[model samples]
Target: MPPALLVQATAVELLALYRSRSASPVEALRAVLAHVERHGAPLNAFALLDEERALEAARASEARWARGEPVGRLDGVPVSVKDLLLTRGWPTRRGSRTVDAAGPWTEDAPAVARLREHGAVLFGKTTTSEFGLKGLGDSPLTGITRNAWDPRRTPGGSSAGAVTAVAAGFGPLAVGTDGGGSIRVPSAFSGVVGCKPTFGRVPAHPASVVGVPPHVGPIARTVGDAALLLSVLSGPDDRDPFRAPPPREDALYLGALVAVDAPGASDALDPSGALDARFLRRVRVGVSATLGYVDLPGDTRACFDAAVALLRRLGAEVEEVAPPFADPGGVLRTLFAARAAHTVRELGPEQRALLDPAVQSAAAQGEALSAVAYLEAERQRAELALAMAVFHRRFDLLVTPTSAGAAPLIDGGALPPSFAAPFSLTRQPAISVPMGLTSAGLPLGLQIVGRHFEEALVLRAALAIERESAPLRAPPLRAS
Candidate 1:
């Protein structure tokens, strides 16, 4: 097979190849290893590429397949993980030099365990910002992660390496964490699909704190891949206090799309995957380019307006709706800072020095927040959540530009845009779909959001738009 073919195949396609015996799972693993070594110079996406571990797993999977034994859905497929998540054999530095490489990691995170149970071949660990504190994938510990589309541009962050690996085909899918658009920002900038499932919808213990809205999510090239990954990751766990009860309807999210347009689906008693035609026929969509406050890029407004027009053209009722709450960013910052301060309060001065400047600054701010100020911020968070609840009651879906604009060049540092943090605050399920390309050839993305825990609707709406929009192609890996 051509190297370019390896670059373009999706997780679903790889599964089909394995099932049909067209390619041995071990051979597929080798393809991933070869590509990683070949593209490492240009992509700079990986923190560690475990060739021996991945190939061994792949060979074992192939053996299981030969024996006609049961295997996990993702069996034999190579996948990368964000460095923020711990893996037993691999040293998880989380892009921070302060972390001791020899620290014990005897247990897998719930999501990591699920991936292993599903037979995913863990290819390697991708880079991350120190403690995932910043948007751009740059840290003093790990060098900057550049965009695959343009080596000069950023791949987006704090899930920077995960996004870059997907774009560069180090793997077909990646597991990422989103505290404040860590998953969505990179997905938007890197021209991949990013899914932030409703908070507590996935098992994310060993990472979650008291009330923070951090979530474990999937970053992939297509909605199907994202859904497949989500399925593998979503479930209850004893370790996580916030693990939500399993959805009443346990269906494959990727398969949900196939049933979306089927006859009688709209009228079906179960509304899980089916769209309400009456509702969708003239879907009420609220579009906001600037979210009523933040400044947006010139092209951001244009592309968003264009997307709104496209939705209207598709027979949806599109209008500009002011968000119900005010100044979510301020509240979010306070809450984040407070959480950061508490989480890292135990680190010694020497360990703290190794943290990113942004992380340190946030930690300091968090430490200084008075109880009254923190409570006020908490109040604002509740108010914002209610406001979103009311907003979605009126509109079937909310639409906005995924990022303020295209991915920035990885130089000093690329910051996360205002659009992502608010939704994280709201804990609404958001999907970042590639909308179009800018004249500069950078990918522009559109974000579709749904009510809390309404990933079905969010994915359906995104798929509808994706069906109409041009697919985002992977950038060719070439020498810089």
Candidate 2:
């Protein structure tokens, strides 16, 4: 395969080439590095690119492939890690200038360690908001990570760089952490697939100070690729007290959730026609345009309506149903602010001054909360989670627009409203799949959420939508 074509290939496609001896990991890595160097500046997607080490890993993968003994599932796949997660031998500054860049960057976050163990070529660490506090991509440390569709627009973040990297073809896969809407927001804005698996499915080491609301998951160009990465990222790690124990079945259900080639009832059927039937046909989906509170922009609502129409066409039983709980924003913010306060409380005035002003303000607000208030927020969180669990008993999935609007202008300071955070609070699996481009040519996403630990169902439903919808278009990059 030509290097250019190889650079655009998905991890699954590249694996096929490696097995057939048509393309080598060395060639793919070189093409990817060159592409990143050429287009990276305009996107500002990378915080650090470890070319030397990445190339060495690629060479080893090539040798293994030549011997017909590849290391693991993602043996030669190029992947980018969010800067918030520790990557061995690389400084994870967390998009904050206050973090020391010198020495002892020795441990890998659980997800990163899993990638390394599976022999993935860990090429770079992508940028994030300072401590991943904001939805927009800019940081004092990395300037701004721009939208792939239009460089003048913001790539909704805190997983800013991760989605931009994948959308721009820097690599086929990226590890993204979502606290609130980080992963889904950017994925929707940049026209890629991002999955926030049920919280403990992917372990976290040195967990986010914001508590268990944060989740580490995959960002990819397609549902299958994201599922592939999730399979690797899931499972227990001793370091993460929150990590869930392995399921007794010892199965990675994602492999069976690949997109079906055809669009109707026949294609939706599981391998055993009797046992599972067509998965989508049996699924009950509840469509909530606003989750009962968010006021979506006109264009965003239109896109979401179209997505719902597509799901209906796929033979799934769909209906509009308001979620049982009220807006949990107040509770969520209280917890988030408290976490922010905890994050910077130990810092000296000089270090505090280095923090993002918005984050600083949130931290200050958190500091003012009484112990009673904090505990009350926790109580609210528990109540909301229970409500959602009850709601899911009647519905197999909840569908909504990922964000309330398209990407904001680069100079536009405000972040758009999103439907992603409530699920984070509930710890349910949610995925943002590209719906289509708006009339303005900006991307929009349809968010499909499943009951807690039902990642397989979320991916399977997403695959159905992916099959019926238009292919995700790569952004037209402006000349640097």
Candidate 3:
């Protein structure tokens, strides 16, 4: 395959290329590095690129592939991680000028360590919002991470760089964290697949300052790729107090992917990449266009309705449903602000000066909350979770727009409320898959939410939708 095509290959496709000797890991890694270097500047999607380390690992993977002794599931595949996570040798600046760049960067975050263990060619760290505090991409440190679809637009952030990098073919897969909508919002905006596995399904160390609401997840062009990476990232890690127990013997992430493509799977279980509609039949899917709070925009509503209709046509038992609980927006805001306050309080005056004003404002809001108010928010959260738990008793899945609309212009209105904050509050597994693009060509993601630990079902359902929807096209850089 040509180097150009190599840069666009999916993780599964790249693995096949390595196994067949059609492409070496070094060749693939170099191709990606070049592509990212050439086209990545406009989007400013990368925080740091470790070319030497990535190439060295790629060479070793090439040797292993030559001997038919691949190290693990993601052997030879180049992957990017959001900078919020630790990387043993790289500074995790978290897109904050306040973070020191000096020595003492040690230990990989659990997810990063797992990527290394799985033989992934760890390459780069993507940009993120300051402490992942805001919704749009620009941070005082990394500047703006423009949407790949149109450099003028915002790639709905905190995981801004991760989603843009994945969408632009910087790498086939990226590790992203969602505290609120970090992963899914950016994925929805950038036209990539993003999944926030049930809280703790993928462990994180030094627990997120945002508390139990944040989750580490995967970003990719295909649901199968995300599931493959999730399998590697999901497992017991003693460092995370919030880690989920060992995955049930019956509920593996990749098993879901394989089942989603059963008749097409081979001994190698190579992801077919082609969409299959065999899944989702008889699956009870509940649809909530607005979650009964935010006013749904006309364009996004039309797009979402079309996608939901398609789900019904695919044999899903679909039902229109009212919001299960009262609007939790205020509760979410309180929890979010309180966490921001906790994080900001630890910073010294000098470091605080470097923080984004939005972060400061959010922290200030948090600081004003009395202990009683904070507890009230927590109480509301408990009630909201219970509401969803009971509501799911009747529906196998919940579908909503990942974001209220397409990526907004960088200088225009903010990306509308994703209606995603509520599900994040529930700590259930949810995925954002590209359903289609707006008439103007921007991507729109359809979100699928599932019960706790039901990641496999989420992925299976998303894969079916992905297989049936019109595939999103590459950005202009590679456009025909």
Candidate 4:
């Protein structure tokens, strides 16, 4: 079997590839490794690659397939893990040179370990923002990760390279961590699906999470692929004390997605088939151009309006609504600052000086937060979460622009703190689905915010929009 013929490949496709013997698992791993090696420098999507180790794993998987031995669902698919997560073979540098590569990392982070147990071929690590601190991709250790569609624009960050790798077809699935829009922002910016499952859904405790924020999730080109990856990655890890108990059996996401996919399920499942019920005419949605005060560009608002209208056509009720709580950003700023200070303040002075200027500046400000301020931020966070809960009770979902504008240039300033950070602060699950492209040809995205952990509904509504928007096939990258 030839490596070049891997079809409209996704996690599902790759699983099928292994199931049918047209291509051996080793051949698929080789295809992915070769693809990444040829394109890695151009996209800067990966921070490291373990070709020999990955190939060995694939060979073993091939042997299992040949013997009719049962294996985990992801058995031979090559997937990328973001550099921020701990993996045995790669330097989990968090996009910073401050951490020494020779130090302890004898085992995988729980999510990483799960993928390995499931037979996922962990071929390499993707780039991340320094300590996963910023939204844009440039970092001291690995430099910048270019957008797959247009290199000049930012891929959107912390998970920048994870989405880029998947977008560029270096690999079909990549694990991405999100704090303040890290996963969804990049996924939206790069024209892919980014799922930041309800906080703690995929338990992780990277060196960056001292402030009690941040999550590890999946980024893929489609919702089903994201679900497939999330199923493998989600579960409690003993190391993270904050990890939530395993969710109720009935609400397990992947199972819910399948249950939602049943036929003739209007009123039980929406058209996209993940929600518990079909979209009713006039299902109220609170539309916000800005989550109240953030200025929005006209084009961004227009695109959002178009998306809202489409929802209406699908029988959703759209209304303009705002959370009762105001100026939650101040609280978030305090929380993030204190957390950042705790996580990075101990870095060697020289290393601190070398950090991204924005991160350094933010950390300094964070260090200045008083204990009183941190306490208040926690209060505000709780209040904001309650406010969102009330808002959702009144309206089915909240619709907002995923970004203030279209994907910004690669070197442009970070996006304003608005729609994304608030939800991140509240711990409500949100998904950024590709809307349409801006006149400039960059993809525009709309965020759908659901009640806490109601990811199935969010995914269902997102798939509905995805079906209506019909993402354009990003033409292959000139055959690598």
Q: For every model shown, what is its TM-score relative to the native structure?
A: 0.92, 0.95, 0.95, 0.90
Model 2 stretches with alpha carbons more than 4 Å out: 208-212, 248-251, 256-277
Encode model 3's per-residue lDDT on 40-130: one tens digit a residue: 8888989999999999999999999999999888999999999999999999888889888884888999999999999999999999999
Weakest 10 consecutive residues of candidate 4 by summed lDDT: 262-271
Q: Rank the candidates by lDDT, best first.
A: 3, 2, 1, 4
> Model 4 reaches what TM-score against the true structure?
0.90
Clashing pairs for model 4 are: 268-276, 282-317, 283-317, 337-366
Worst 10 residues of 3 by lDDT: 258-267
Q: What clash pairs does model 3 have?
A: 275-467
Give per-residue lDDT, candidate 4, residue 190. Answer: 80
Residue by residue across 285-377, what tens digits does model 4's lDDT show? 788877767787777778888998888788787787765678666776677677678768678888888788877888898888788877787
In candidate 2, list every pair of residues with a backbone clash.
Answer: none
Residue 158 local lDDT, model 3: 91
Model 1 lDDT at residue 305: 76
The global Cα lDDT (0 to 1) of model 1 is 0.79
